[model samples]
Target: MMIDGWAVNALPGVLVVPAVAAALLAILPNYRATARLNVMATTLTLICALSLFFGKPQPGPYLLVDDLNGTFIVLTTFVGFTTSIFSASYIGHELEIGRLTPAAVRFYHTMYQMLMFAMNLALVANNIGLMWVAIELATLTTVLMVGIYRTHEALEAAWKYFILGSVGIALALFGTILVYVAARPVVGEGVDAMVWSVLVTRAGAFDPALLDVAFVFLLLGYGTKVGLALLHAWLPDAHAEGPTPISAVLSGLLLNVALYALLRFKMLLAANPAAIAPGPLMVTLGLLSLVFAAFMLYRRRDIKRLFAYSSIEHMGIITFAFGMGGPLANFAGLLHMTMHSLTKSAIFFAVGHVAQVKGTQRIADMGGLTETHPVLGWSLILGVVAIAGLPPLGIFMSEFLVVSSTFAREPPLAILLVAGILIGVAGLFLRLNSIAFGEPRGPAAKAQASYVPMFSHLALVLVAGIYMPPALVVWFQNVAGLLG
Candidate 1:
C-alpha cells in the first residue's frame, strides 16, 4: 500500500531499528560509543517516522496508521531524537562528576532506547490492548531510569512513580476490558472487538451505558499518566528527581502519548450519540488542573519541580481544548500540544545546563544567570517568555486561539481559562526574573553541553508563531475536523 507516495512496507523499520539498537547498547560497556549509537538510532527512527507522512501502511487488527496518530509519531520521534543529543552531553557531565559509573551509563543508554521504542509502539498500535502494553513498558523503562542514580530521593521518586503508575495501568486495563465487553455483543468476543478502527465504526451500535462506565475508568486511569490535577502527585517528584533528559521526555512525549490514548477512546464515545458528553468531564478536570497547578507553582523550591507544575498547567490547557470538541478548538488543542512539547523540552534543556554549571537545582542559589552565563541565561529567558504565553511565541498563538474559541462558545469558562493563564504567567515571570537577573548567588562554571538542541527547538517555536506553513496548517485542520 502507498500513502502520499511512499511504500507502506517501511513502517516496520521505525519500530525495529530502536529495539535492535537498544539490545546492542545493553551489551556495550563503552559510554562514548553507546551514546553515539543512541543518537544514531533515534535519528534513524525519526527518518522512518517522517517517511510515514509520504505514505502509510493499511490498518490491521493489531497495528494502524492514519493522519491523527501519524502526526503524533512524527512529533514523538523528533523530540526523542533531539533529547538523545542533549542526553549525550548531559550524561557525559554526570560521568565526569562521578555521579554515574560506566555501568550505569550503559544501562541508562539502553533503557533510553527502550523507552523510545515503547512510545513509538504505543503511537502506532491498532489494538487498544497492544497500546496498553506498550504504555506499561514505557513506564517501566522510565521508572528504572529515574532511579538510576540510586540516591535516596531518586529511589523515593521512582517508587512513587511505579506505585502510582501501576494503579493507572490496572485501571486502564479494566476500562479496556469493559470496552471489549461492550463491543462483544455486536462485534463478537474475538480480535475484532479489540481493534480501534473496528470499534469506532461499530460504536453507535454498542451499549451506551457500558461505554459511559468504561470512559470514566479510562479517563481517570490514563489521566493519571497525563498529569491531570488530582492524580498528578507523581509528576513533580519524578521530574525533580530523575535525570534531566528523562524529565524532558516525560513532559515532552510520554504525557502526550497517554492523552493520545484518551483521545482515541474519546472518539469512540463521541461516535455514539447515546453516551454522555465527554467534553464536560474533560473540561472540568482540565480547568481544575490549570488552576491547581498555577497556584502550586508558587510553592516550588526546586527548578525542575517548578517547571513540572508548568507542564501540568499546559497539559490542562491542551486537555481543555480537546474537550471543547469543535473544529477550531481541536485545532487549537493540537497547536498547543505541539508548542508545549517543543517549548517544555527546550526549557528542560536549558535547566539541565544551568544546574550543571551552578552545581545546584535550588532556585534560591541560581541568581544572576545572565551576568554569569549570557548564552545559557538568555536562552532560558527566551524559553520562559515563550512558555508564559507571551506574544510572538508559538504558545501565545495557541493560547490565543484557545481563549477566543472558548469565549465564542462558553464565556464563563473562558474567563476561568484566562485567569488561569494569567496566574501562571505571573508565577513564571516572578521566578524567571530572579533566576536570570540579580547578583550571582553561586559559582558559575561554563556549560559543557551542546546548545544546538535547545536553541533549535526555540527557533522552531519562534518561526511557528510568526508563520505557520500552509501545508502544516491544513494538516492540523484536517485532523481537527476528525476530532469531532
Candidate 2:
C-alpha cells in the first residue's frame, strides 16, 4: 500500500502547528495577538486533519490513520477550531472585566494549543502506551487551566481534578503494562508489544487471562477519564470553576478523547475470543452514569455545573450504545458521540455567555432569559432541546436508534435505558423552565457575545437530525463493522 506524499505532510503538520503555536504563544506578550494566533493555529491544524481524507500513511510502530480514528480526528479538530473562535471573544470579555489578567490569558492560549497537540497526538498514535502518554499530557494541561484563576474554589476544583486524574492515569498505566506483559510472549519485546495495530492482529495468540485482567484495569482506569458514575465527582467542579471555553472543551473534546482510548482497547479485547466480553462492564458503568447523572442534575445550583452533569449523562448514553456492540448500536453510538460533542459544547458556549451577562452561575439567580435576551435565551433553549434528545434534533435520531436497537436485543435493559433517559429529561426541562421563562431576574443588559460559533454548531446539529449526509452514514457504517 502506497501513501500519498501530501498525506505524510498532513499528519505531521497537525501536530507541528500546535506545538509551534504553544511555544510561540508562551513568549508573545499581547493578549489580542495571542487570541488571534490561537484561532489561526487551530484553523491550520483543522486543515491538516481534513487533509487525511485524501490519503493516509500506513500503520507503523508509532502512528497510524484508519477509518475509526479518521472520524475522531476530523471531529476533534473541527470542534477545537470552532471553540477557539468562541474563545477569542469569550476571553476578551474576561480580560476587560479583570477576571483574567494578561498573563493568565497568555498562559491560557499557550495551554490551549498544547492541549490540541496532545489530543491530536493521542488520536494518531499507533502505540497504546504512546496514546496513554498523550492523554496524561492532556490531563495535565486541563488541570492547570481548571485552576488558572487561583480562587479558593478554583484551586480546590483543580486540586480534585489533578488528584483523581493522576490516579486514573496511573491505573491506566498499570493496565498498559499488563497488556505489554500479555503481548511480550507473542509479539516479543520492544515497541511492538505496545503498538495498537500490532496488538489487535496478534491479540488472539496472547494470554487470555492476562488480557481479561488487563481490560478490567483499563476500563476502571480509563472509565475515570470518561466520567462514568463512580468516577465522575471531579467533572462538575472542574466545569463550574474553569473558564467557559475550557468548560466547553472539557465537555466537548477531552472526555471524547478519553473514550477514544477506551474504544481502542475495547477493539483489542474484541479480537481475543477467550477474553471477557467488554460489553457487560461498559453497560454497567454506562447505565450507572446515565441514571446517576440524570438524578444529579436536579441538585445543581451553578449553571455551568448543571451542564457539566449533562455531559456525564450524554457520555453514558454513548458508552451504553457502544456496549451493545452490533451494527445498529455501533452506528447509533457513533452518531450520538458526534452529536453529543456538538450539542454539549454548544450548550456550554451559551451558558458561558449567560453567566457573563447575568454575572452569576447560580441557577436561582437567572430567570426570564427568553424575554430579556432573546438571542442567548432562544439559543440556550435550542441547545437544551437538542441535548435532551427531543425530536427533530440529531440526538433524537441517534437515541432513537439506540433505544430501538436495545429493545430488539434486550428488553429489560432497554427499559432501564428508557427510564434513565426520561428521568434525565424531566430534570433538564425543570431547570430550563426556570432559566428561560417567567419573571426576569438580575442584570438584563445586552451581552457582547460570539454568536457564530454557537449558532454554527446548533445549525449542524439541526441539519444532522433532519438528514445525515450519505458520506457520513457510509463512513459510520464501515467503522461500525470494524468495531466487531
Total backbone collisions for each predicted model: 0, 0
Instruction: Tell me how candidate 2 scores on lDDT.
Output: 0.93
Candidate 1 global CA lDDT score: 0.94
For candidate 1, the 10 contiguous residues with the lowest summed lDDT are 1-10
Query: What tens-digit string does per-residue lDDT give for candidate 1 at 71-110?
Result: 9999999999999999999999999999999999999999
Q: TM-score of every model? A: 0.99, 0.99
Pairing residues by index, what is the TM-score of model 1? 0.99
Over 425-447, each residue of candidate 2 has an lDDT whose tens digit, in order, gives 99999999999998999899999
- After superposition on all C-alphas, the RMSD of every candidate to the true structure, in Å, is 1.1, 1.1
Where does candidate 2 stray beyond 4 Å?
1-3
